[model samples]
Structure formats: C-alpha cells, structure tokens
Target: MNRDTLKNWQSRIDALSLRERAFLLLTAGLILGYFLYLLLIQPTWQALHQGRAELESLQTRLTALEIRSRDLASGRATPEQERLDRIAALQTQLAERESRLQARLGGILAPQQAAQLLQSILAQTRGLQLRQLHSHAGAPLFNRGSAATAAGPAVGRYNLTLEMEGGYDATRRFLQQVEQLPWTLFWDSLEYEVKDHPDAMIKLNLYTLGHS
Candidate 1:
C-alpha cells in the first residue's frame, strides 16, 4: 500500500509545471532553513552573545583591579617619611609631658617661699606651744653645676625641724593642715614624749624645683 501511494505521488509531481516545481523547492528550502536556525544557528548566536557579556564583565573587573594597584603603588609611603611621622608624634608627646611637669612645678615652693609658708603655718597653729623651729638651706639633689646654670630647672631638698608642745587633737589638726599644703613635703622622722604635757619633734624634707 505504501509503495502504491509513493508511485501516485511521484506521477503527480512529474506532471506538475516547472514553475510550480521551483516554487515547491523554494518553500521546502525555506522550511529546512527555519528548522536549522531553531536547532543550531539560534543556539550558537545566543551562546556567543552570553559569552561576550561575560567577557565584558571580566574585563571590567580586571580594569578596576589594575587601577587600584596603581593607586596603591603611588600612595605607598617611604620608610623615611614613616620614621619622620613617628618622630613628630614623639616630639609632640614630649612637649605635652613637659607642659604638665611645668604645671606641677608651679604648685611647688621655692626656698624663700617655703620659709615664709612655714612661718605662716606656725602662726596658724593655735594652742601650739612652740619649743623650737629650725629651717636649713635647700640643696640640689641633681648636678650642682647644671643647677647653677639656667638651662632648665633643678630639684632641691630642704630640711625642716619642728618642735612643739600641744594636745593630741591640736597636733593632729596641725599635721593635717600641713599635709593640705600645695607643696610636696616628706616626713623624715617624728619623735614624741608623753608626760603631764605631750611634746612632739618632727623632721621634714621638702622638695622644690628651681625655675630660675
């Protein structure tokens, strides 16, 4: 049956006009081309487009990395510049510390000032019977030659001996007031004797910095 059908169709095609045959051939070619485009050509074109887009993205990333690398190279600091920056920072810190030291020194007392202050303290101690009071000259604890020169400042220690007779409460109040002074005072020794009247002998060392 299939062979008969093919023979009939072939006879019909053989009887067709040449123009009609050419038209049919053209139509079949167009259909074959369309199928080929759908199966192979369209897929290849889409793949190529996607590949081009990916390549463009990769190129953009590469370009950005190159720019960053160049910037880093240009902005890199030399070792000498880094060292200079550190030195400047250290100098600033040193200046600040010196300022603080000067401020602290301002609160201290000089030899003459300390003598006057001690006199004032003695006057303020009410109900304190003075036995003896002695004040020695101040001497530098550091280099004597540098202290004589006006390069910076020098630290000095002054000795003071205070002997007084008073009750326990009055002596304690006096000591508290002495402690509240702005200057730094060091208690070297203290001797006390209890009898009908209590008496106290105290030796103190005072520290001061020379501004002159």
Candidate 2:
C-alpha cells in the first residue's frame, strides 16, 4: 500500500526513541517536585527553624532570670539576725554610759562641805591647840547637785586652803585626824616654819569634794 508513507512514519518514530521519552518524563517529574517543595515544604521548614530559635532564646532568658533570683535570695539577710546585732551594740553602749556615770559620781566634791569636814577633822584631832586658824575658800567646781552617775545624785567639788600653828606632835595629830575623817580631803600643799618656841607655824592647802 504505500511504501513511502511507511518509511516516513518509521523515520519519525526513530527520532523519538523509548530512552529519550523516559528521560523527558523524568526531567518533568523532577521540575514539578521542586515547585511543590518551594510552595509548601520549604516554608514549613523555615517556620520550624524560626520557632526553634525563638524557643531557645526564651529558655536562655528564663535561665538567666532564675539564676539572678537565686542570687538575690542568697544575699538577703534575716531580720532577726540584724535585730540581734543592733541589740548587742546598744547593750555595749549602755554599759559604757553606765560606767562613765559611775566614774563621774566618784569624782564629785565641794567647798563649804569641805569646811564642815575640816571641823569634824578637828574634833577628831588628838592634842592640837586651836592656834591661829585661816581658811581660804575657792570657787566650787560644781554646784550642789547630782553627779553624772545614773544611780545617785550628782555631787560638787571645791578647793580649800587652811593654815595652822602648833607643836610638831599636835600638827601630826591633826594630819592623822584629817586622814581618818569620814569624808575625803586632798592635802594639796603643806609648809612648816620652825620658830624659837617649841611650836611651829604650818600652812596647808586642801582640795575637797562633797555631795549636797
């Protein structure tokens, strides 16, 4: 029937062989899969990566905050301990104040009171003749008042100067009497002059402190 037509068809079929058809189909399938991945799977993978990064950042921030909180908690001091320390410091201050008050109480004495004390001392003197007696009263160091001590009234202090003339034995007896008196007197100065008589002239300076 038509030998020419058969030959043309056969030549056309040979141009597109089975191997070429298979290769063309494979290339078309690979292109379609790449488009699908770009549209759906690639976006999903990007979103997953972003979400993982955000989660990691949040975790790191949380860890840092937790560590800071723990550090702050550890650094906190208890109120009880702080109060106890304050109490101890206050107690020490109180004790010091009390000691200072006691010392102040011990150092207080006054002048007129010292004169009366001298009279008492004279009463206790053994054999002294009441010779020419002189007394110079100085300003009182403190008024008749309480000492700085917490327990008792403050006392006052003063300086007193006294002079007397008598025998040596009588003067010694007067000094002994002064030392044995109930109150305290500081013998600041003493001067004695010898005369042709058996008796001697004596001068004395006294510092006395007394309470009101």
Cα RMSD, each candidate: 16.6, 23.6
What is candidate 2's lDDT per residue for 145-189, written digit by digit as tens? 122233344334456666666778878878877777655577788
Instruction: Output candidate 2 Cα RMSD.
Output: 23.6
User: Which candidate has the top score in lDDT?
Assistant: 1
| lDDT per residue as tens, model 1, 1-212 | 69999999899989999999999889999999999999999999999999999999999999988877776699755567667777666656555554455567666676567666766776788866666667775665444232133334545566677677766776777778878987766667766666555544434444445443
lDDT of 2: 0.66
Overall lDDT per candidate, in order of appearance: 0.68, 0.66
Error of 1 at 9 (Å): 99
